[model samples]
Target: MSIAESVVRTIEDKGAGAFVESYDPAEENMVINLGPVHPSTHGVLRLVLELSGETVLDCRPVIGYLHTGIEKECEDQTWRGAVTAVTRMDYLAPFHNEQAFSLAVEKLLDLEVPPRGKYIRTLMSELGRLSSHLVWFGTSGLDMGAMSAMFYGFRERELFLDFYEMVTGLRMNHGYNIPGGVWQDLPEGWEEVCANIVSIMPGRIDDYESLLTENPIWLERTKGVGIMSIEDAVRFGATGPIGRAAGLDWDLRRDMPYEAYGELSFEVPVASEGDVYARYQVRMAEMRESIKLVGQVMEKMPEGDYKNMDPKIMPPPRSELNRSMEAVIHHFKLVTQGYTVPAGDAYAAVESPRGELGAYVVSDGGTAPYRCHVRDPSFINLQSLASMAKGGLVADLIAVIASVDPVMGGVDR
Candidate 1:
């Protein structure tokens, strides 16, 4: 039977008595409501766990607390303005969100990003992945009672955020990515700056691993907990480290090359153990792979236009806007009215830090999208909660949830 079918069967068989009861049979079932406010839920996620003492009988993840009508909001904004809305969907990995939206827009325009632009994008996206994993490692450690790991992970994450701030002027919600290409070119000395980060991060990753990789406490908490096989993961649509940890060799960057990823060299780490430690190992190895890609980007850095030069699609150069009336008018019109796209539907998928984040956009040859929806991986992957947590102790529930690393913003958006 499929995972969904199995879940229904389990719920039907085991939950019939509980449903008939007027109130939760607290003493009999040992029912516990795990956090609509719990920090480990990632954000406003609640799990209604029907349990007998410490062992979970069934699990239902409760979401929708952070929904902001982002898809509906996109309908009101011009295509250019819609990036801001989608970027907020996966706040931790906003670059992937922007990349998916940009890819869809590029498909609509029949536009091709220049080699340099693609390379720069790959660099930034990998950096964003590293930043996101750092947050995951930090917060997961905090959830598991390793407080110092949180500090160490965030300390390393700040370096990447500093690089982002240097490039985009904002620490987060950087509207740096726009349709056709990025908003601006890489700043001067950007190569050196990126190289420096690449040089230092591997050792820092080792530091993080030193704290948790073989530590007896961490191993006891994570190893052999929340195990899920490759078949189970694929059936449930899990991706990124969650799927990879189960020996699924699926990564959109490699399987479906988007942007400049085809030219990059990096390993997709997989662990067959399919446990919480395996997930942790996959993410740690991915951090190293990201560092390798950053070095490659710096080595092959090309020189070219960052944004498209097409006047209709891209904004005119600032120099042209100062001296040319035509340039000023074009810029004004593009910003205020936005460019139109062909009437068609397109989908773009990127391997977000959490999982495979895909955007499906439909355009009716208008400035705004006819319909916009995101296939948030966290939302889909969270469905496997019962599969992983079914027979595990309540304590293991926190560890399993942390390993999956569901961002509620992505889930509820």
Candidate 2:
């Protein structure tokens, strides 16, 4: 019988006290609520699971519990202000959100970011990638009941967070990557700090690998659990580590280079396993790659303007404002009214840690976006949950959710 039919029959039998004398196999079929508030779900995601005994027969992910309507709110903010809204979506990898939005606005304005600005943006992007993967590693370990891995992952992640605060003045939701370029240049002593991070990060990754990569329990829980074939991944629009784990062999950094990514060289990690373990392996390799990218940025760091100096788009420096009445007036006008873009629309994407994070913006010759939308990977990737969760034991559902790593802020936004 269908699960629905089984449920009806079981309920009918229960009302008549049929179970007082005998039990029915159909009674074994059950449905359960997994989240919207539970730990191991990663965010405010609700999964309605249909089960037969301990095995999941079907799974449905219900989202929007954390929705704040940031996308719609973007329509009300000025071009320069929208970055603040988008940055909050992923929260874990806010730089990618800002990068995607900034790139789109720049495209709309036909603006160009200088070499130094591009490099700085690239530097932060990779650092953000490292921070994001570290959280994923820690949380994934937590989901798998490996307490030590969580401690290790977060310990290393704190270093990157320090770097973020030094650069952006805030660790998360930093409106650092503006439309013209970055809001400011790298502060003094940035080189020493960045060098210090890359120096220790590789060894730290090795530590993580040693802890969980070959642990028999880790392998048993993740090796063959939550497998999603490459064909299914593509159809469901999975990307980043999820698609890479399935052997999709595509990465926007390499395939569709942007910012300073084209100038830098790094391998896109891919595996054919398409299982929970493969997802873990790919992200671990990516953290190593991000470290390399950060090192490259430090060595090839260029000297130039960090933000486009367009008087209409960028406000005058505070130093200049005190010296020149013209600078003061210009700054006042720009801050109050903001710059306008020509009538057009554009879409720009960056390979976020989650996947292809894209921002689409439309201009109506106004200070604010006429329309704005983001193709958030977390939201798209959540589609694959049903496919991966079904036919797997209920205990393995946590691993599957962690492997996908959907951030609800991005998903619901």
Candidate 3:
């Protein structure tokens, strides 16, 4: 059964009253509000935990602190301009959001990106994956009281962000990936720069493993804590490292290839233990896999037109715009009015560092989309919290929340 169906079943089997009961015979259960502001909850999420002392009997996640009506806003912007809004939905893995939105637009336009564009996209996406995992590692460690690990992880992540800014002008919210292809080709000396960074990252990852993987305190804090069975993880709609750690090998990049992912080879890491340590191990392995994919994309880099030649779909080259009046006009029209799409619906998904990041887009044969909805993995993954947190110590609650790594931007968006 699908994840949604599984959640419904679990809810049905374990009735609401079983998890929570009245605090007083004459009153309903005491609802403990755990933050639209608490540090442990992460990013402005309020959890209504029905608690009997320190033990959580039941929990309901209250979102919307970061909600920006981004999906509704997408319906008003031009197709090319919408990337900026969507990228902010999952701030850590912006490229996946861009890729999903762009792919859906490409499906509407029926345009194919050139070989060079595809390889660049693969490189960027991998970098994004690595950066996101780094944040997860760092913050999860900090949340569990591993202060040094947090600093170390962010240190490496800064380097990755530098590479991102070099290629895409902006460190985040890069409207680089357009409908037909990427915004521009890689800058000069970019390959050597990227290669140098790639060579150094594995050693850094090794450093992280040395610090935490076998450390007695780290192990105690994480291993076997907040255990969720494989069945429960799938039932809760967990994805990315959270689900994969529980032995759910559901990576959209591998299972449903898009862009140049099919041409590249990488392993999807899975661990049977669905606990904090297992999630950490899965993300660590995934970082290595992302590095491998980036290396392959660099080696197999191709030469061709970056964007599609179709004038209606893509804007004219800058050189052409400067020299030709017609080219200038075309560029203006493409930017202001946007390219029209056929009246139909398309769903495009990518294996984001978080999970199956998907976009469901509908067009009414107009310049703007009729409807756009995102199937955010973080939003779905957060659903499992009550299941994992129950029957565990209050201290383990922090680890459980960190393990899932639900960025409220994605959840609330």
Candidate 4:
């Protein structure tokens, strides 16, 4: 269909909520900016809103406010070192970012990560998902005027951050997932700590649901508001919670297994409402699944090397360097010059909390990548904002933005 036909159809279909409403030409449509600074925009996102009274007529997302050119910077660093930059793209789900870049590089080298390493990656990735979703749950509640949900969400999220610090030594943007595997093995007594975390999550999720799921105010604000049809969601490239909420039953983890996902079992949470409430339901269900996956990883955790032992890609162990002069030289060269990848390009994607996070790497048989690009779900999911917000109340727009959950770091990267 033509652009005009689509716009008219959208208007006609929307009925009382139509975006293109007939208004007096003499009374000019009000133009307003929602934010590059507003809290609900979810970090440096500006929505140029054309409004008639309090209803949104047109919404245009103005991004690049937080752009740091990280993709270009990745090209300047060694392929192994690029994870540092990639992890910072989606600050909320940093491990997924790291995993995507690492997987792409591993594909280029035809390297297989050890079973233990894959399990560790899977464990960390799921923990990261929990962390990301917790923040979303809290912030979404805060947006709807339920202040306590914000505090509760952050409180639960801190536990996972502690777990991250215990394992990776950093809470956010930890470059733990390297090309061949993880940076190091789990710390002593990690299994006990992980078990405790998963065990308590079901009750905590119950707490979250009790607070907002059936609350009359939340239901009034969210149900039937900011609805997106499955077609519009796909056209807008919305994925993750948003896509699943719209009845798009596509998940990269289940459909395209990576790491230890193929060996693990978990259900993908899906909903058909495609509203703010449906988005909430999808994410909440996902957190429960993440907890289940974490428990499975602990039970099925394998025993083996945590990293690839290849001399070409990995630096010699510290024990080896003490006995052999060649090990010393190899370690020095690997640290300073990095390993060379065969001339080729590869793309690897992982299911992130927000959506599909992918990395594309090109090599010229050199240490550094010739080109590096990330397909961030936040960037693509942000496109659905206009469709969701169009014809909705200005207040409802805040809820819609919160539901979409576009992190500017990823969107502008």
Off by over 4 Å in 4: 1-27
Flag the better candidate by TM-score, 2 or 3: 2
Instruction: Look at candidate 2 and tell me the lDDT of residue 238.
Output: 96
Q: Model 3 over residues 1-413: C-alpha lDDT tens digits?
A: 42223333454466423332224444433545566677877789766665556776666676778999999999888887788888889999898898998898888878899988888888899999999888888888888888998899899988888888898888888877888889888989898888987898999999999999999988998888888888988788888888988889888888888889999888889998888899999999999999889889989999888777788877887789879998888899997798889989999988888898999999999998889899999999888887888767677888889888888889888
lDDT (tens digit, per residue) of candidate 4 on 160-270: 999899999998999999999998889999988898898889999999899989999999999999999999988998889999999999999999999999998999989
- Regions more than 4 Å wrong, model 3: 1-30
Task: Write one digit per residue (lDDT tens) for candidate 1, span 201-286.
Answer: 99988989999999999999999999998889989988889999999899999999988888887889989999999999999999
Candidate 1 lDDT score at position 197: 87
User: For model 2, how does the per-residue alpha-carbon lDDT over 43-62 read when each residue is reduced to its tens digit?
Assistant: 88977677778898877776
Residue pairs with clashing backbones, model 2: none
Per-model TM values vs. the true structure:
0.93, 0.94, 0.92, 0.94
Our tally of clashes for model 2 stands at 0
lDDT of 4: 0.89
Query: Candidate 4 at residue 200, lDDT?
Result: 87
Residue 124 C-alpha lDDT in model 1: 85
